[model samples]
Target: MGTVLLAAGVLLWSAAHLFKRLQPAKRAELGDTGRLYATVAIFASILLMVLGYRWADPVWLWPRAGWMIHLNNLLVFVAFYMFAVSGLKTSLARRIRHPQLTGFKAWAVAHLLVAGSVQGVILFGGLLAWAVVSVIVINRANRDWTRPPEAAIWREGVALVAAVFLMLVVGIIHGWVGPWPFGGGA
Candidate 1:
């Protein structure tokens, strides 16, 4: 049941996100209510995903390796930095058309690297697939993109700092909520 809920949540999330892009006319026809519906669906999907993930039984695929953890840490750092780059609209935004989704893919892959359970694979792999499909769809739909202007150099530093701060906060929260990341038993 938990795995089913998780799968449903992932599917719902993808559907809601892609609806606007895939059916712009239908979305527009619905007017403002479309946005409301989408928001509600997204929230519900998130709730389902959280509950399902926490309650799901594990089916391990592989043994955990020390190197995998280290790699996950590095990739996670890069993922967070990429997210910050997108949010900050730093110079990187000018070059990377979809930094946010790219970062999301990175984050998913980082989790997949350390994930041995069936639930973890489904969650991360489904999200990763969604991100990949979204990128392809978006690129095909809009071939021409107006890149953002070159941002100030200081903005890059701020983004880096933001990434570090976010990583620290997330690490602490993750440790408290789940397994302690550093040398702690899961």
Candidate 2:
């Protein structure tokens, strides 16, 4: 049942994201309303996915390695930094048009490395594929890219600080709810 829900949630989320790219004319016709509906579906699907993943029985494919956890932690930190910089008016943002998607890719990959269960593979692998496809679709859609205005270097510093703070908060929550990120005893 949980696997079914997980698959359904992944499909819903992927479909919602791809709808605009697949049917641009239809998406434009709906305008703001379409975006709102898509947003809601994405959030709802995410909720369902999380719940399904938690409830599903674990079927580990391989032994958990300590090094994998360390690597995942590092990649997650980088992902958070990319996410933080994506919204900020920084030079990095101007250079990386899809920092958010890149961050999502990193996040999904990081989790995938550590989680060997069927649910983990479905959830993280689905998201990674989505991010990859999204980047490709977006790049093809926007042929002419206009670079953003230059931002102060200090803005990047601020983004980095914020990223660190976000990482701390998320790590704390992860430790509380699931695995201890630091390889400590669960």
Candidate 2: C-alpha lDDT: 0.89
Extract clashing residue pairs from model 2: none
Candidate 2 on 90-144: residue-level lDDT in tens? Answer: 8998988888888888899999999988889999998898889888998899888
Expressed as tens digits, the lDDT of each residue in 15-125 for candidate 1 is 999999999999999999999999999999899888889889998998789888878877888888999999889999899999999889998998898887898888999
- In candidate 2 the C-alpha lDDT for residue 18 amounts to 93
The per-model lDDT (C-alpha) reads 0.90, 0.89
| Predicted structure with the largest TM-score when compared to the true one | 1
Ten-residue stretch with the least lDDT total in model 1: 177-186
- TM values, all candidates: 0.95, 0.93
